[model samples]
Target: MASVARSLRKVFVGGLPWTVGTNELRQYFSEFGHVVNAFVIFDRNTGLSRGYGFVTFGNPAGFNSALNQQKHILEGNVLQIQPAN
Candidate 1:
């Protein structure tokens, strides 16, 4: 079997609502494309949101789509989305 090489499509999301969860993040981003994975960074000690997260897309197209958008509003808060290093 041949191995398929896929380009990683990950984006850094910031300014998330304090109450935002992984499921909500994935649901919101899913509008752009297939969401491979979604996670919200948390404060290990407090187990609370760090106001940031990551969203991975199944393909580069989805990543670009979300990136090109002006801004995303989640729960009345504007989200900061950028290409993840």
Candidate 2:
């Protein structure tokens, strides 16, 4: 239980372009804070982006900064951000 509670906070990002990848996702969110881990879900069969991703912040400040922000635009698309369930 303590391990789960200490897990890095993740933020869900939607509306990402299919062109976006892990590197781009990490780069974009780095502005908010240190990104512990960031990944864009990809279709194994097609090798294409699924248009969404997850970002884990190294600390709470980074997590909250990303979550509190009203808008996040990446790759010419307005990204939807929220806490991951």
Candidate 3:
């Protein structure tokens, strides 16, 4: 459903807390702008968070907004954000 995973409008967020779920992730990122998609990766077998996720924005403005922010904190933990590979 995506043109490409490496677009500037997409970001890879690592260091997500176990408590951060898909909906929560979407909500947090909504501050920047309309979030096209957001979800936290999870371990398939254990059903726990894999401590990483991806976010796709509706526009590059949202992506740049998020990227320009100095820090991102969620669930009391700082997150590592980078452009999607």
lDDT winner: 3
TM-score of each: 0.89, 0.91, 0.92
In model 3, state the lDDT of residue 25.
93
Q: What tens-digit string does per-residue lDDT give for candidate 2 at 1-85?
A: 7445435478889999988999999999999999988999998999998999999888899999998888888878999988887
Clashing pairs in 3: none
Error of 2 at 78 (Å): 0.6
Error of 2 at 66 (Å): 0.6
* Residue pairs that clash (backbone atoms under 3 angstroms), model 2: none
From the highest lDDT down, the ranking of the candidates is 3, 1, 2
- Give lDDT per model, in order: 0.89, 0.88, 0.91
Model with the higher lDDT, candidate 2 or 3: 3
For candidate 1, give the lDDT of residue 80: 91
Which predicted model would earn the best TM-score? 3
- Candidate 1 accuracy as lDDT: 0.89
Residue 46, model 3: lDDT of: 100
